[model samples]
Target: MASRKSGKPASAKPAQPTAPKYLDAKRGVANWTQATEWLRVRGIEDIECITPDFAGVARGKMMPSSKFTSNTSLSLPSAVFRHTISGEYPEETGDFRYDPLDGDLKLVPDLSTLSVVPWETDPTAQVICDMVTTKGEPVSYTPRNVLKKVVELYTARGWKPVVAPEIEFYLVAQHEDPDYPLKPPRGRSGRTITGGQSYSIAGVNEFDELVDDIYDFSDKQGLEIDTLIHEEGPAQLEINLRHGDPVELADQVFMFKRTIREAALKHGMYATFMAKPMQQYAGSAMHIHQSVVDAKSGKNVFSKADGEPSEAFFHFIGGMQHYVPRALVMMAPYVNSYRRLTPDMACPVNNAWGYDNRTTAFRVPHSEPVARRVENRLPSSDANSYLALAASLACGYLGMVNGLVPSDPAYKTVNEGSVDLPRGLLEALSLLEGEPAFAEMFGQEFINTYVGVKRGEFETFMQVISPWEREFLLLNV
Candidate 1:
């Protein structure tokens, strides 16, 4: 396994076990007896029981396949919920959600996510888990649980939300030193990317081995990736996932990122989903295409019989316009994410909706009535996929429920540099802190804990002095 920041292989740490409460919570857990037998028959030795932390990083225990039985108990520290991106716990204050005892939470494995590790030398299988209390109640703050709750909102209304992600990332030379700058690695053509090559076929074929490996692993993991393309930035590529259930898509993305990173490692390169990994190039984005369909009729809810947009579509756009500004904390989760939000970067700067327009944050593509959908271009590649989709759908869900109407579309317009989006993580955090929708959609306790961790990160970042300061200010001032 590798640390998110360093991209270097990290030594495996032993799991510290907590006493299990021995409660049979079978709601999230599936019938794993057959799955366990399947793994055993395939000679799988290690089973990685994984869970996504607040930062969206995979963290969990690796146990022998033989140890995975009906009585298997997986418990982790409750403090894991409050861990920062750097894998450290910030000081707690006020009336915090977690008690001073720092008790354990049960991790129930999701049997459906079980798959073989294609890259690992050892025969290994991995399964995603959900965090739960001793009494079998879901931890509301968990990203997967939050998404499930939001999906229930649409389910209750006889509608189903669908999402497809266009995730952009960059391939760089593997650099061991954290301070060293990363450059593009040589592709199949024996040449490194030198300039922007948007939509260039040669650019994509340049790294044929890496691309092929990505597709291979994605298929092996049952990730239905639709397409891959050379994006605007040098060494940047975009992978579009097939549209499906929102929760399934989020789970795919969560695994896809790790799979890509591991594939890059095997190729002696590094793949980064960080929004602005390079100062000179455009930022990476995770643009999610969404639409709603009738649960029973299976008709597009955003379209009408005559092929025109419906009132629900307008309200959905209106909800996005009303709520996107406050949801920036989830869309652009890190300080680096803001660097990609500038007007000139081809990223959306406003919540304006438009028909077949890329400038607006909400873009309605030209599609048949059944395929009618809106593309939200605000979220960065660095965001947690589950939370981003949940926040986005929640906003639109509220709009449909409240009968809100959107403003005029910003059709074929350029960035006027007048949008009022928060320009930094700190500003976004402040907006989210005061917004009631955030508390309503994502639990109040979760919001408070997330804000606290982000605040600590921002404070820590402020204490550092960058090379730019020394280079420009050391002698001049």
Candidate 2:
């Protein structure tokens, strides 16, 4: 099996001699027999590691199966919680925080992610977990914890946020030639999968083997994927999942990306959730479609009984519109990612909303009262699905709670010269530093750690020259 490039081993779990009583009571795990039965049914060879990931950052462990339990205490290094990709925590790099190298952190699985890996006969499956202390205290900076905070706010207001995601990924074939490492088919430059069939039809037939695997795996996991279509660009596939309560949908996305990547690998292909992978074609997006509902009565909060656009909906859009500039980093996090926002790249650069207008950053999908919702099309495929949804809904809450009404819609109206998105990671950190409200939204510790890690990546990328620079400026300069 191809190892995950930068993550913990898929199954590095602690030994589970016997399932602990605490684990049995947590969820549907009634006893050791039930737990093993579940594992057996899925053909999981041995449950290895169960850890938490914070917005693409790995902060947990890869446990051995023998220790699978509700009370399994595992310690992740303190550095795990900090942003490694960006090196956000320079001070905490070698200090003891979470284990001996850091400290002992608790690991508990979220059973909703349980499912078999069709690509693996033994399948060796695992689930995402929460990082807690031996005292059972939750880690606040973790993306899951942050999302729970947002969900609590909605619960208090007797409302629940609905979230669904349309995920896109680029599939490229790997090759041995170092000079031309990724040898795609002839004339097939990137994501859209060049060939005969195009745009949502027989085109995807060329990759049916893996697409079929994706559909089967998603169904087995109860992911509720509504549609999978060929994107406008070659080799790009968009998977549209059904909207559900925020937490459930977030779970689906978390598992779906992991599964899709693993599945794609089985057929000699690689899947990248990076917002921008192709230099000359359209970049991938993770469009989040959202709406809120009355928690108990299950009423559509965005629609009125009279069937007109409700005040709640507009305020929600208004909040989104107002916060987009500050929240741009989260929706489109990477430096290369911003380049995809060109007027015709299928990316909506304008921070505006409209009824059924794809050009606007916020697109209101035309549907019945029950289905009416706003689709935030700005999010990049590389985004942390959980954080993206949480922050977005949080911004919407700010809108509804504060009654933020936006000015009438405009076309890419925000002056590009005034405050353009960060052209690189350093610029993003700079923008993040300036936005007190957004920084405060995720809290101080998280912000500090995130900025540290991203800066490291930015510095690293700067040291290396790109193929473009080599071809254009090396000789001339």
lDDT of 1 by residue, 268-377 (tens): 99999999988888899999999999999999999999998899999999998898888888889888899899887778888888989998889999999999999999
TM-score of 1: 0.91
Q: Mark the 10 consecutive residues where model 2 has the least summed lDDT.
A: 181-190
TM-scores for candidates 1 onward, in order: 0.91, 0.83
Clashing pairs in 1: 188-206
**The candidate that achieves the highest lDDT relative to the unseen native structure:** 1
Candidate 2 global TM-score: 0.83
Where is model 1 more than 4 Å wrong at Cα?
1-30, 93-98
Q: On a 0 to 100 scale, what is the lDDT of residue 472 in model 1?
A: 100
